[model samples]
Target: MSSKFKKRLKQLHGSREKRRRQSTQDEQSRVFTADDVEEQDLGIATSAVDAWRDHGADSRPTARGEAHFLVRHHPQSHQHGTKRLAEGAAVTLEGFRKQLNDARLHSADPSRLVFLDLETNGLSKTSFPFCIGIGVWEGSQFGVYHYFTPTEADEPASLSACAEILRDCEGLCTFNGSSFDVRMLQRRFSHYGIEHPLDDLAHLDLLHLARKLLPDRNGHKLSQLEEDVLGFGRTDDVPGAKIPGRWKQYLKTGSPHLLLDVFDHNRLDILSMVVLLPALAEGLGSSSDSARFKNRASKSDLGNRPSSSGSDQQARPPKAKPKTKLASQLSRTYALRKKAQSGGRRQPETRPTEQARQEDVPRETVKLAGSFSRAKLRRGMPIGTRLRELRGEVERLEREGRGDEERDEIVHRLHEMVALSPRNPFALERLVDYYRGTGDAALADHFAKRLDETSPF
Candidate 1:
């Protein structure tokens, strides 16, 4: 007989109806219900034009009779960056072919490649992609075109718009489109009975290559690389996990205001890949190229950036920054904050993760984190415990005549080790011998000084 008991009983089976609809159209007019909102067949016929009418100015129907919602960076006014993006894109295609182990991808021309990203409701048959972002070379410039679905009825239109534009391109590129985005599109197309043109197109999913290239990055999420390695972070951006909810909010309220955040989020994801792809491809070509890429990413030379988040921030993940011993970088981060505070603007809050990124040491740390550094090889082995292990990697390279860049990077690691354990003498003597062989008596003397400092003899 209690009201609380009755409410609990009402929610148990979702037997209570949320909304009622009168049919000027076929839509159920029902809002989200406990059982109805699950990603399954809603039994609503999405293909018919009679189901939905314009709710207001913000919600309208596209010419194709699909729901239309978020569109941004319209290619008409969007400009191409000054960098030779065509060359960069082509090189990126080659890198993809190398990593994906697929010869079929060669059919994709670098001159006509397209970058693709999608925001979807969920991964169920009824779940749909609400927004699609595609970046293509337009005339002399690279432009990004956005296609969005306004309602469940609009999903097909968004995909149709996307397919029509992409039909002309030689291939497609995505962050991790291989496993999720592309596959989802293909499935939806199959369900809709439309021919999926992308089926035969070449795809270069950067996610897989990112794993091979940035093993030090841990989980390999796009956001992590967006800050630490790419040196471009977002401000006031929506966390990716919340993206689906943003779309659902618009769906229920018919307000397009917050969708702008999704537009910005999609825009940045596309542009970052455009900028980052070439820098990464160039590294795959050679060791020197890798060194140069490290320098560019570390510096501000790779300039395409996203809006960074504001003062309300959380602690950044550990190992996000490169393991360098520079104290000056930390000092500079504080100086920038003090400057901001004095200017009357809210000072950007610094998290522990921000320190290394604020240091912005450069791409060499990214490259080092991957395969060519002593950091991964040096985990937890002390100078006393693993002098052999300490010298194992660099010694192999030296004996094989294989390490040109490896030698330069290893010497820094050796210096750190010798600093930590001068008494061991093994690392110090090797440094002296290595520096002397390389004809740097000044450097050799530096290690010898440590040796002398550590021992009386």
Candidate 2:
């Protein structure tokens, strides 16, 4: 009898493992067009919508068939945020702009940028996004719009809310979006016959970047980076892998409030991205721009917003320490040598056997040597908003024979364009044109070098 019982347990384990593998295979298959989807898929979308309607879950305005979903919309403003930077590398928006330009992206507007994270019931195609948390810049304040799917039927409405929010976003930032979050959501949208909306947005996958810059670090996971680079850590947070089980328990028995931890987990994920942006942007600067940006966010009720899980663990951000003058000078010398080689000017190779000849890492260079991270810096307004009007203004000014005045205004705009996007070769080239037209050889040459340095191609 004991042997029979053992045999049964082995069979059960084998069956579960087989199902897990099959689910993974299903997730790998994606729907791209109507030809790939069955008409029955649309019914699932409809039933999900019906579920929301039947449950009387709170509704938000959605364009996709007036579907109602449980929405947890928290609009934030007028609150001073109390979060403080732990005095790591100080990075300015301007500094990050340089890196952005290097990445060769067109724009990274704050208002049009949405930080997204999703929680789901499963990892494979069989699962749907149960919660979608979006951190967006609302005027000067940051607001998180969480779309909660309380039941299976709420899937359609929840997805629609996310689609609506994403429609206007110019870019999306995620820790590992390209691999999981994005691919899974796209699959969900395709399965439901709803158009995938994020295909066009500028996608910043922080995980890829972190891996590139922190190759020597112990691990490149967000949590690892939080501990190593940002000095922030989590407390009593629900493990992501166990989230689905918690939700399933809620659905089956509805006895526990453990789902709140999931929502809070989603919330902290959004905030972690928020807090890390400027710090990652700063690189090894003397002090972090986190404090500066936090101050800007503090004006609105966002100041007191909690970015971490609990107050149990405080971030042990690296202390801001200046490098000794000797170390700083040697670091510069080594940098110059590398830059010269990259410039194809290396003429010879020599090895120094003398211990003193070997340049020691300057303490100052240590900060700059830290691995890179990610974040955003706000600009005046979204790009498309007044561009046409500005063009019209320029045309009118030019037609009215205010060519010189128009040039000045153009220069002004160009200055802003350059400041906002230093890597913009077009802007740099235009500045070169303007300077040349003005017969300012020095200015023209200066801009030309700046343009050359900023150009990605």
- What TM-score, computed on C-alpha atoms, does each candidate reach? 0.50, 0.46
Estimate, for each residue in 1-457, the C-alpha lDDT of model 2 and write its tens digit: 6999999999999999999999988888954677456566666555544554554444676655343433343333221122232211122334444544433235556455788998888887687777787877755456666677655666776677788878888678788888989988898888777775787776766677555444444456677566555556688989899998988887775433656678778877776676566556544244455444332322222323455435543333434468976556445434433432343333322222334235564433332311111121244455444443344544564576745445655555544444434455655686788779867686678778877877667
Off by over 4 Å in 1: 1-92, 291-457
Which segments of model 2 are wrong by more than 4 Å? 1-57, 65-104, 284-457
lDDT of each: 0.62, 0.60
Model 1 per-residue lDDT tens digits across residues 150-242: 456667777766767677888787899988889888888887766668877877777887777654433667775666456666789887889
Name the best candidate (by TM-score): 1
Candidates' RMSD to native: 20.8, 27.2
